[model samples]
Target: MRIALATATGAAVLAAGAAITTVTPAYAAAAIADIKIDTTVSFIPPSGSDSIPFTVKVNSPYTGSKAPDIKAEFWKEGEATTSAGHAASVTALSDLANTTPAPTPASSVEVKGSIPVSSSDKPTTSTGKWTLKVSAYPDGSTTAVSSDTATFEVKAATRVTSANVDPDPVYLKSGKEVDVYAGFHLEKFGDEKITDVRLESKDSDDYYSLSTGLEADDSYHDSTSMDYSTSTGSWQLRISISRATKKYSFTKAFQVKKSGSSKAKSKITLYASPSKVKKGKATKLYGKVYRGSKAWSKKILKLYFKKKGTSKWKFVGYVGATSTGKYTKSVKPKYDGYWRTTAAATSLTSGSLSNIKFVDVK
Candidate 1:
């Protein structure tokens, strides 16, 4: 009986050792779910408008039976600008919905939809490239840990033909308001929506206002209006839009006469033409006044352009003012990016920026 008991005890110990050898160490926290955006461009015939048919691809390397849900979004590159750490002229194209998970590995999954073409989405600068971002969310978790991005270009349907701003010389007194008019036209190239009209001027003051659903009056094609009361003699008025995909713009100027009881006097009005510019090309800008069309003296007006992320402002040479109340300047860009410019006045008060505009460089 003692021998039998000894053999049984030995067998039990061997069994325990085998069990320990068979077990494995826990996998380092299932590598946060991974995902990617896969897309291809297809053109609608005759129209030749570029459209994206995109799908989200997910990978679950872990041994788990179920996968997590993923979310996604799309953004245009180089749409916003900044000067001295302040934000200006930020814009977007589209926001897409999150996709459900696929049931099997290596099986293709996609969000059911198409990116639309519009009049506003026409590429004005930098080949109009945009990026699509996709992110994954694990089930029952608020934290989204996994993400990926895809890059593509938006083709131009129409290029900006001409842009001008008005009132040769816009004269105003300090604390007095004036309406600056810009005339522009759009060439129907793509099918994107161009929206959200605005005028912005900033210099460490953080002052900005947005006007929605406003377009250049029907009477004037390719134009919009804004109200500005000059706080200082020299200031910049930036004209911007809400949506800019396939959107090209040109401007012509119109002035608001000055009113009395204003704190100061503005002898001239200066501003950017086409408000937006395409990178690497020379864009024409005009400065005008209301000194009764006698035109400001032919002095070279100093101007500068700066991108959103950097601290430096590039000096765009002095623009000569026309005797007919207009100052004309040409801007050539060194990089494919988004930028805004400010024009300083010599003896102006009520008028700073007669207007603003935008162009896509890439």
Candidate 2:
């Protein structure tokens, strides 16, 4: 009786040990061996709809009856490490599941999923770094077996939407100054600040350049003066704007026309009193300006002088005419010379030169 009892107890003990061994494989941890993101997706814009695709290699200890779940989570650089703000889930490849309780290599498969980013996810700052983690989980389990992480960048997008130059057809007259204006509008996705805004002529010889910053309405405006020296012909204005590391440029054509023919004719008369004077003696230089047949009052005249035998004329000074159209100035003559005056061109009147006067210094 003792021998039979011992044999039955031994058999029961062996049966229990076998059952425990059989249940061990059911709870083995699944694992994610590696994850690789598509190299083409180097960066994500701060404000837009984007899909990040990747591949995950997984080792599943579970039976072929069910497949493990693969999950991807995204975290910004400064976010807390405890949890991620975005996540995507996908099923592991069917072939990854183990058919038997034997050791097997990890299987690589493209995860048919995407981490969607929307405009609301835009960062307040110009740019930032982001991290992605991929993990594998067994069926109906809350714990992750293993995970792998990768990194990428988030940057703002900038562009210039519209631009224009006021007074498309610039009208220029001899010795007259004209005002020209330029304006621009810009659009941006993130908080990046505009670094520069400038306007320049395509031809360096045109000599027009201006710069300004964006206003509260995201607009830029500036003005420059054009005079007789400015060339009249087909011209181009190149507009450039910069934000962060990006630069945008645009070119626009414009016309500059000479309108001197439409201006009224002008005339000036000049004379030096005491035609013959001792050296270093004071002499009176006087002039009168006229527009057409009428007196040009409150006008400015430029005085010039040159030695009798010299051809180069030296600028003496400026003289303003009175309400009666007469101007005068006292000068001491040191040598025999010729003197003259000129009236600069105006929007309504053409330029004119006066008759020369000779001063003989003894």
Q: Pick the candidate with the highest lDDT.
A: 2
TM-scores, all models, native as reference: 0.26, 0.36
**lDDT at 114, model 2:** 61
Q: Rate the local accuracy (lDDT) of all candidates.
A: 0.41, 0.65
**Model 2's lDDT to the true fold?**
0.65
Enumerate residue pairs that collide in model 2. none
| lDDT by residue for model 2 (1-362), tens | 00111122223323423422112224445556556655344234334566656666655434544566777788865786477557765554454435567545444344655666554555556565777777767677786655667676665445455667778777876778989887777665544455444334332234576775678988778888888656554466665644444345556677665675556568898888888899878999987887655567678899999998999999999999986678998899888999999999865468999999999999
Model 2 regions more than 4 Å off: 1-28, 39-42, 60-62, 89-106, 124-126, 161-362
Q: Can you tell me which runs of candidate 1 are displaced by over 4 Å?
A: 1-53, 56-154, 157-161, 173-179, 199-239, 242-362
